[model samples]
Target: MASALNSKIHAPGNCPGSKADARGGAGWRMDCDPEMHVKMCKKIAQLTKVIYALNTRQDETEAGMEALREAHQEELQQAVAETEARLLQAQGRVGEEEALRQRIQALESALELQKQLTQEALAQSASCRLETQERELRVEAEHAERVLTLSKEMLELKADYEKRLRHLSGHEAPRWDRLTKEGPEPKAEPGCGPEMREVLLEVERLRAENQQLSKDYARKAEELQATYERENEAVRQAMQQSVSEALWQWQEKETDLRKNFQAQEAALQAQVRKLEGDLEHRGRKISDLKKYAQKLKDRIQDLDVQLKEARQENSELKSTAKKLGEKLAIAKDKLMLQECHVTQKTGDMKTERVSENEVLRKENNLEACSLHPQQDQNFAKECPCTKGGTDTQTKKEACIETEYMKQKYEEDLRKIKHQTEEEKKHLKDQLMKRLEDLVKKHTVEIKSVRSSVEAERKRLQKEVEAQLEEVKKKSENEIKQLEEEKAALSVKLQNSLLEVLRLEEFIQQNKACPPRGDEKPQELDYQHCNILETQ
Candidate 1:
């Protein structure tokens, strides 16, 4: 196009060159007709107008490029901010995840501790039950032994009484038999003798003695039966009372164990409630963190969309700048052609016009050279000097802003990390403190409960021992009294036997005297004499 425009402007027979000037080149003239000069002037005027329009378009392109560069920088800053925000959100999520894990671990540990405590408490309770059962068994065994001893003593006393009764009966039976065999010699007499009357009196005394012995035997048997019944009743009452006391003690111990278990349950429930509340709080935090992360993702998406728009606009501005550069080159060529035509008409403007043309040509050459490279360079370096200056300045500002944002992001990340660390430590401390307090409290409670249980058990043991001793002493005293009663009854039996022997000897003496042949054997009524029925 420049070659065609040059051909049109410097064509033959159109204008006079400097070499063809009249008067030795001091003045120059256009060899063209006046009409052609007018046409050329009009064309120069039109070219000036086109150049002016191109200059205006170039200014507009520069302004647009500058604006686009500023917009791009702002978009870059926004993109950096979005990236930083996303990074921060990610970091926050990581921290939250870690915190949640820690909390879960803490809760798990607490649960394990609680389980262990519960197991220990159960073991302690089980051991306590075993001890109580053993004690009860021992008490029952002791009671059985005591009862057996009392029964044995009673049986031995009964056997002894039976042996003594049999011995006394055997000795009296032979004596009675001998007395019966020795009958009195019969002598017939019409009148009664004094001896016969005396013999009759002795027989009457013996009959009275037999009746008295029978009455005494009956009374002693009734007394012995009554004493035995009373001793049995006393023993039964003592056993019943001991059993009742043992039962009451067992009930009290059971109640104490139930109360302790209830207390432990309440404490565990409170701890569970606290743990549930902590879990709920953590859940809320997790939910909030999720919401924040979602918001950050949305913001990043928005920033991505905005960045694409900025890039699209930047490309459009580059294309517009390239088109404007082409238009400027064309306008520059037209202006150069206009100046050549004007300089050919006016001799005085030759050197100035040539210099101006040379400068315009150089600019055209540079623009043409940079045109292809502009596609790969993003038009930043290959752009017009003024445009390049704006691009470089804006780029530097964007870089500074990005670096600042990076530094700020790093600082924020550091702060967040520090805060998260502190939070973790604080939470851990609180958990540890709570766990320690719970452990201490549980230990104290267990100790107190165990001490109380031991004390109660000991007290119950002492009380039972004292009751057993009292029962023993009472039983012994009753046994001693029974033995004394038996001895007194035995003495009475011996006296009765001696009286019988004396009566028998008197009868034999009277028989020997024969009462003067028993002048008259008075009719003795023997029907009134009867032996007593003994048990």
Candidate 2:
């Protein structure tokens, strides 16, 4: 049993006992019957073989089945993987289709939206055009209204102006008074005015545009326009009214002012006329005075010339008187000489008479001598005489002697007396005749010389008077002309003063106020300006 136990233990299939290789002996001693052991070993071997076969078969079948399961699992995995990949591909295709559909839908939606937007834009543009047209109409209406209002106002103003003009036709004190002259002259408008119609048209246009907008829209769109319209109208009306009122007042005042100015100008013109007349009268008076002065000067010159002539005449007369005196002296001397000659001739005649007488006496004496030649008369002569003869003879002798002596004495005395008487008579006759002739000749010559000298003096005096009169007239006329020129200059200076005052008033209109003085501005050129060109 032990061996069976060992054999069984050593057996490959089933073992009951100890194992073969355990104790060691057959190489450990067959511990059981050998045949039995052999049979057992054989049976064990058979069983081992059968077990090996069966195990091999079972292992192979398990391997095959495992391989098949693995293959099937692999197949299943491949199928599952293929299905998953196909399903994923299908899902991807579906997603791609969905994405494409979304893109197409988006494009269609965008096109529809674009069409709608175009339609909306057209509608909005039409609405805006309508609104703009409405605004234009409203603006035109406002402009018409403004024009009508302005026309009405102008008509009223014209009517008022005509009424005032008619009222001015009635009589006042003198149409104007002097007190108005002391007031200021009215001024023209300050600056050059623009066309009122143009400004009104612009304002109407803006107002129309403003009215076109809705109140809410105006707040958004025409806020500036609305404000401008209100302000423009207010300013226009205020300024227009101010200008119109000023114009009205000015027009009303202008009539009286014009009348006053006309009156003042008329008075001034009258004064100027009077002054001119006075000036003319003065000039005439001066001319007459100059003429009278000329006459006086002429008279004085004539007197002077006459005086000089008289002086010359006096000298000539003195010379004539001297000549006459000399002639008288010469006549007197000639008369004296003639008297002497007459006296000498008379004496010579007397001497001749005396000689004749002496001749007679000499004859008588000769006769006596003849008779008494030889007679000696001392004694009485004894003669044969008759008695009468002797006595007569004696007496005759005595008488002869005595008569001779007496005759001689008488001749001498007569001769002397005769010369003296002849001289006296001749002197008296010659003196009287010479005096008469000399007086007559001298009177004629002096009268002729005096007349000629007086005539020459008168002619020279007349020429000198004419020259003096011309000089005096010229001097008087120059003085009168100078006076007239001075008067004219004074009038011109007054005109200049008026012109300066007007100019000052005009300039002061631009200033803060007017100055009351006649001051003027002055400028001085301190530098000598020259332009020199150099080439």
Candidate 3:
């Protein structure tokens, strides 16, 4: 009994005995013989040892379950944190996409504005071209009208001079025929014979003077006709030169304007083409970005699915942990009941000892205690419960790895987005620079064209002015020459008319004389002498 007491005190099961002592009392009395008491003590010690071993196994199971729960909880928290971070990154990417969309809209609006400006400029150029055409037509019409007027004036002058020449020829023909037909006068009465002879001589002299006057008139008329024709030709040539110069200037101006307009149109078309190309490039980039965003969304959805699966797995693990804890509690309760039954049995069997049977029972119980550890080992191996912590750790690692992949993907997407933005900026800058250069080049060309046109116009105007002055001077000189010729012809006509009147007066003064044969002979001699003097 002393040995049994010492064993009981030293056994690992003594921890439960404190509760048992509290329930039963500090000391208990047993009504049994010494041998039965010793046997009961031995059985009690063996049962306590078995109970202690079972308790230790239950504690190890509980500790493993707790660790698994902690590991699973940690893994679940990490998954949740990673998911939140990915969601935040996704939202940031969405914001960047929205900003890119707004920039595209602004670019489209700017392109539209540029198109409108180009159209307006084209319309203005077309209107200006139409106006120039109308002005040219008007000038041509005015020039035609002036030419017609000049031609009509020339025709009228030619008809008037022809009529005057015809009338003068008709009058001179009758006068010449009458003068040639006159012969010697008929014999007159003796008293009027001398007067008649004197009148005949004087009439002959007047006819000769009239013939000279007609020849002078014919020469003057021929000269006047030649001068008029020359002046008309000169006037016509000058008018033609002026008209041709004006037409040529207009043609040059029209051609230059057309060239400028064509060049501008070509430049505008090139600019439009460049803008179109840029727009297409931007559209392609936007499409790529959209595709990338869609890919990101798909990845995010995959992550969400993974997260859900992880959450489901965590819930399943929690349920399993709860089941294990419940099973451990039931086992502990059974062990406690068994310990109670064993204590009751020990109290009852203390006075009825069968030594050999008790010894055998102790051996069996010792063997059961020894076998309990093996059962625990087998359970730990086969149950899959103890591996929960390792599984949770693996799942946590997977979750961390997925989070890192997600972060990498996000970083890659951000890099691509930034690269695309930089490319867009570079393209825009190049386009602006090209457009600015084209504008400056076109402006310089326009300035040079304008200056050349102005200089040409001034030179043409000077040439036209000089030609007009020369024409005026030539016409004035011709008119002055004609006036001088006309004045000389009139002076000669006046002197011939005075000489004819003096011969008529001399014939009248000799009309009173009568003549005999001798007087007649004297008269003939005097007439012959007068004819010789006149000749």
Top lDDT hit:
1
**Which candidate comes out best when scored by TM-score?**
1
By TM-score, how accurate is candidate 3? 0.33
Better of 2 and 3 by TM-score: 3
lDDT tens readout by residue for model 3, 269-387: 55445544544554454445545444444445544544454454445445544554464345334434443444444433332333534664576567657777776566446435534
Estimate the TM-score for candidate 2.
0.24
Q: How do the candidates rank by lDDT, highest first?
A: 1, 3, 2
**lDDT, model 3, position 54:** 46
Candidate 2 per-residue lDDT, tens place, 1-535, comes to 2344344343333312233422322232243224433443443344345445545555555565566556656755765686677568667756865775576467546545644654454355346434533543454355435434433444454466446445543333232343245355423234412433444465566456434422333243233334434544454445445444544543444444445445544554554455445445544544454455444444444444444544544454455445544643453344334333433443444455557657755765666666664453311242223334543553455345434533653464366448646855775586567557755765675566556655655665566457446645654564465356445534644453463354335324423331111111000010001000100
lDDT to native, each model: 0.49, 0.45, 0.49
Q: lDDT at 106 for candidate 3?
A: 66
TM-score of every model? 0.34, 0.24, 0.33
Q: List ranges where model 2 is wrong by over 4 Å.
A: 1-253, 366-535
Q: Write the per-residue lDDT of candidate 1 for residues 1-535, one digit (tens) a residue.
A: 4345545655554445645432222222233233333443554455456556646665675676567567656866876786687678768867876776686567546645654654464455446444544553454344334434433443454455446556655655664465467556444344635555665565567556545644554454345334533543453344445444444554454455446545544554555455446545544554454455445444554455445544544454455445545644554454455445454534434454456557756876786686775553553444456444654553355345434543653464466448646855775686567557755765675566556655655665566457446645654564465356445534643454454354346334434543211121121111001111110
Root-mean-square deviation of candidate 3: 29.0
Answer with 1 or 3, whichever has the higher TM-score.
1
Candidate 1 has its poorest 10 consecutive residues by lDDT at 526-535
